[model samples]
Target: MSWIYLDNNATTKMASEVLDAMLPFLQESYGNASSVQHRIGREANQAVALAREQIAQKLHVKESEIFFNSGATEGINTVLRGIAHAYARKGKHIITCQTEHKAVLSTCAQLERTGVEITYLPVNKTGEIALQMLRDSIRPDTILVCIMAANNESGIIHPISAIAEICQEKDVLFFCDATQLVGKQEIDLQRIPIDILTFSAHKFHGPTGVGVLYVRRKRKPIQIPPLISGGQQENGFRGGTLNVAPIVGCGKALIMTNLHPEIEQYRDELEKQIKLQIPEIMIHGEHAQRLSNTSFIAFRHIKAAEIMTALPHIALSSGSACTSGLLDPSHVLKAMAVSDDDAFASVRFSLSKFTTKAEVEETINDLAKAVSRLRSSSPAWQLFKDGLIS
Candidate 1:
């Protein structure tokens, strides 16, 4: 009757446990983390240290390797820009896929203006890039390979482990945008060994405005020039008064993270029901490995905006929240070679751990009715029904 939120990829409701952990820092523990001379400052510093340790433990990384920032966007900018500047002498070439988040793509675009050579790899219909193509794209001058572990729109999971191995063999640094991968699955940096990774707390039921950047140092050190220059903080990697409350919240959120199988079941059931009840619907990335909680569906002949408008009580997304306001079709869908009409028709429903079967069932019914009603007034749908168009 009120709202059925299925936009978890855009952001999640902060977990009560995370909020509880952050309260003390926001109130009684409020002190300058940089001021270590006083007791309050020492307490703040200890909380930050504990939070960092918690995140490190969850990621199977060292505390010294973790750096906190505003969120994944800032971390991405920091990594791409820092690498471009820090490794310019080594090589000005970077390799990344076209489906990367706007943060990565835009940063690469900016670097291109500065005479940096960026190779944008193409992905197949399933949104998975050919590993051989990636290997071939890597030149002797390639300093870094940047990619996302999971796509935010279609939820397609790339073969990051293989990509890592290829980069490792080539002795090139790799940066993974794991914002969509974090908290949804277990990550052991020791096993996969990504050169650098970044994630946002808000993507995993933690507070907004906080994120982590993991820089590898066990095998070969990664030197990233600071993006923000001010007082020495985050080991001089990020300079600012640490966001004590959100940092504490982020750590607690990561510690409490766990895989939810039932959410996947709900998502699958929702998709199955929608397909069974409605005709001419296509599931994007259905054949590929994807995040369990995401479902991107395109109802042919019906615009995604119209669908969302029909189901007013449900929270849904046409594409990435960052790019939603733009009238163009989703770039992610376009990259997968989807028709422009289907790209415009696509809707992303990202379930959270809190999503329930009852809500999912209700949504199926509501969506089916909305689509049927809209299609009745649509000439395109009539053409599709008559087999005049597909």
Candidate 2:
């Protein structure tokens, strides 16, 4: 009746337990985690340490491997730049996908200015990367391979285990941008053979401005130099006062998580109902294994902005939240070889554990009505019916 939120991949509502866990640190126990002498500081430090262990347990990694940071953006840059800076003598070459979030693409671009030879692999129409393509891309000069565990826009899960195996064989460091899929999907680093991984707590049901960079150091400690240097924090890999509240919240969120098959059913039913009503629509990444709570849809001959405007009560986006302000077609769609007009016509509907069946049903009904109104008024739709633009 009031508002239906479907743009959860951008961020999720923090779980009640997560919020409850954070309150003590925010109010009464507000001592800085880095302070050494005071009891309050020691308590805060203990909480941070517990949170570190919780996160490590969730990922099947060592507590010492976890380094807290602002969010995935910082985590990604730290891994990318840290590898480049520390291992430049080994290789200046890094590999990633073309459809990566700008946090990665932009960082690689900046690295390019400094003589780094970056290789961006292309994905198929399903938004899935081929394993052999990745193998062929590697060379003796390649030091790092960066790929996402799942795509933020399309929700298509990449073959991370295979990618990591390739990296392990080649002795190249692998960095997985698990920002979109880390919590929703189970990732056991102990079995995957990935060297470095990044994720944000806000992507799950935790507060923003807190994230983890899981560096595999159980075999041999990684030698990445800290990006921010001043005080010795995060084992000197990241400096500055630790965020105790969000870290505790993130830890609580992770401990309270599970696989949601009901959410997947809701997403599928949402698509089925929408397609039955609006027959000409396309569902991107439908064939690939994807996140259960995501649906990226495109109504032929309709602009995504128009649909959002028509359904004001339903929250949505045309692409990743990082680039939602931009008016151009989605770069991820374009990279997957989707047409220019179709790319502009797409909208992303991301759900979460809190998303209910009632909300999804309402969204489906509202979306059909909105699409009908737009398709009737559009000159492009008229041209499409006339077979002028195919």
Candidate 3:
């Protein structure tokens, strides 16, 4: 059976170019990046440095600002926990949105247990935090404002530029979890003014286990204490022997990323067809600007689990892959004022640069059949047909 992958937001398929770029480092050139005394080690260090430069150049950031790490989870933890510890004297308060990834939310929760005050800004029905609310939430003690560039589930893009400006005006550090936005959108550090940002490689056809943490080094030169303290790996910010192969792969993947404007067309077509076939479905974040590769839709009376079980050949998600196994509804949908039933019914279909129009058409047919078949059996769906519920 042929498979159609629509879970790019969760992780993308590694590109052949990225694998080719990483093979040398993984096989013969295997050496500790820190052990530069030997030729192989020097070569490894050089490769890592080139990888950093590639990423920096692609993202329009300085080379020194880029630090490689395990992934976005580590990067988020490094920024949040590191700031909480390093800047504790300045303030004990931080602000973040309620729909943030588990990395940001979990880190904030942990910080709260340690006596740090955290304010979770709520979103509207379209998954957007109000700029006025954000401006009002800033207290004198607020040190950091954490928000993502794009949501993992709904693909709703927060007003990152405006949010950064607000944080700048308030003199608070701003950290953007751009894991879902990095390759899908252009992030020019020179223009955005975001103090810190994090993104993973696997989200953009790079190998997993390696990612970037970009800390602004110019202008105000924000510095948080090192999250890991060892023998000066990652400029002493993260201390461990570098995973050179994946880093090289990440660089290649980033450099190879070319925004596919046509992806939005495909996504729009899919949503249009899905809505025509399944009128009871509600498209989450439909009013807001979202990533071109994503569509989050909820069938009113059919649960997402039923749809997934029916369409086993399609690779998609009910929500964030990290929390998909949990019985509870998605925190993202709940934050957007979605009903518990709607949240459970929501499904995310994220495309990639490599996704073709034919695959999208196939997916539409599969989804329509699955939804119709499921709704046929659902008693609640029958009640809706009988005009019992809206």
How do the predictions measure up, each by TM-score?
Answer: 0.99, 0.98, 0.98
User: RMSD, each candidate, Å?
Assistant: 0.9, 1.0, 1.1
lDDT of 1 by residue, 1-390 (tens): 758999999999999999999998888989999989998888999999999999999989899999999999999999999999998989999999999999999999999999999999999998999999999999988999999999999999998899999999999999999999999989899999699999999999999999999999855578799999998898788888999999999999999999889999999999899989999899999989999999999999999999999999999999899999998888899999999999999999999988988899999999999999999999999998899997
Clashing pairs in model 2, backbone N/Cα/C closer than 3 A: none
> Positional deviation of 98 in candidate 1, in angstroms?
0.8
Pairwise lDDT winner, candidates 2 and 3: 3
Among residues 3 or more apart in sequence or in different chains, the pairs in candidate 3 whose N, CA or C atoms overlap within 3 Å are none
User: Which one wins by lDDT: 1 or 3?
Assistant: 1
TM-score of predicted structure 1:
0.99
Q: What is the lDDT of residue 239 in candidate 3?
A: 86
Better of 1 and 2 by lDDT: 1
What ranking emerges by TM-score with the best candidate at the front? Answer: 1, 2, 3
For each predicted model, how many residue pairs clash, with residues at least 3 apart or on different chains? 0, 0, 0
- Computed on alpha carbons, the lDDT of every model, listed in order, comes to 0.93, 0.91, 0.92
Looking at candidate 1, the ten consecutive residues that score lowest on lDDT are: 216-225
